[model samples]
Target: MSNYRNHFMSHIKTTIGELLEKLEQHNWRHSVYVNEPEDTSIHTVCFVIDTDSAELENDVFTPSIAAQNGLREFLPVHDLQGVREYLANVGVSGTPEAELFAIMHYFKWDTYPSERELAAYQ
Candidate 1:
């Protein structure tokens, strides 16, 4: 693995560990799956919600405050304020580039948000 890969994995493990510990501290037991991206071309950082699980499902509907902070660091842009709107305007979808951006962003990698998603907002 490249140094970046190792560093990123370390960050991921640390984050997950902290999250799991918080759950345990609250006397909450949970199951977690740390899945790696399957396709070689797609480096998706994903969290799949088990639709039946209350916590995970609740998480999905909520916007991620962390997403903006992490996204700003990874993307070339100096700001995150307009990203979701930008993505919407740009018409970003499941295209490979969009997929990569989504996946990488989840992993805290800063691929720029799709311009199409942004343009449509105006």
Candidate 2:
């Protein structure tokens, strides 16, 4: 994976880990990251979505879908929603991590999603 994507992926994982602490299930997997093909230099973040809604008690990393290390089951974008969008549109945005995830989630998923069952975290 590109260094940029790798950096952001780790960032999202950390963010999700923190988010999980506040959720009902503090033990569910949040997200995963991996390098993408050279064709797209930007990067890719895949959010996992389980229609079954089963609870996972440990950290999950799903790479079966691709060669890079994406979170298990699926991945989700953390941005692309609420004030964050407003901030970016108004030129007052540029927060790292979350903002980056939002952009990737919105563009990446929109351009190509592993499956339609789940949406980017946004």
Candidate 3:
């Protein structure tokens, strides 16, 4: 792989690791997944916190609502913000979808676009 690719991969891995560590300290369990809409071009990464401890009436709860109820904190506004900022500094677009795609690509996750396609968003 090229040196630039290696550097980007290394940075993303480190950023994720640190974010996981912080989440763990807050007793938040997390998982990553790909959300592939029917329109495949819009596939995006999802970072979810375990909600086992959250109360649900009729199973209705958004991440923000769960966080308000003492569930795992909404990572996007807190931890993931750092990742977004890093992506922006590296010339990636600031949109959530763009950040998700960049994270998915760097982490070698499922549903990521090709390197050339991703580069176009930078």
Candidate 4:
């Protein structure tokens, strides 16, 4: 990975860490899968979260108010099939140029909203 890619990944990891911490505190569990770009592909970051249950069908993971606001920039997947399709279409490997574009498309970090913005999102 280039220095630029490494830096971006580090930033994303840090943001993810903070989000995970908040989610865990609120009874939300998550899993993240990252596919590093290869010679011709792009990086793919897949984030999946669930509630207290471990079972795929049983777990009812709804984004908390804070999480929802914080993740406003991401393309939220509502169905398992959609998530699977996204992963399948965007394989884990890509060239540096492709990866750069991938960074702009996937695994985006989000921002927290103020009280008024929060109310609007709700």
Query: Number of the top candidate by lDDT?
Result: 3
* Count of backbone clashes, every candidate in sequence: 18, 12, 0, 5
Q: Tens digit of lDDT per residue, candidate 2, span 30-109?
A: 33333442222223443333222423333443333332343333233333343244444454433444444444444445
What lDDT does each candidate get? 0.31, 0.34, 0.39, 0.30
TM-scores of the models, in the given order?
A: 0.25, 0.23, 0.31, 0.22
TM-score of candidate 4 versus the correct structure, residues matched by position: 0.22
**Runs in model 3 lying further than 4 Å from the true structure:** 1-29, 33-47, 51-82, 109-119
Q: How do the residues 1-122 of candidate 1 rate in per-residue lDDT, one tens digit apiece?
A: 11222321212222222322232222112222233322313332322112233232244632233232231122211122233334545665434454434544544544554455324333
Model 1 stretches astray by more than 4 angstroms: 1-33, 37-47, 51-86, 109-122
**Taking the tens digit of each residue's C-alpha lDDT, what string does model 3 give over 1-122?**
11222321211112233343333333223332223322222222223433444344464644443334333322332334445556656666655466656554544443334546657676
Please list the Cα RMSD from the true structure of every candidate, rounded to 1 decimal place. Answer: 14.9, 14.9, 13.5, 16.0
Per-residue lDDT over 1-122 for candidate 4, one digit per residue giving the tens place of the 0 to 100 score? 21222321212222322332232232112333233213212333333333233232222343342243333223332222232333335453223343233333344323222234223222
Error of 1 at 44 (Å): 8.0
| Candidate 2 TM-score, C-alpha based | 0.23
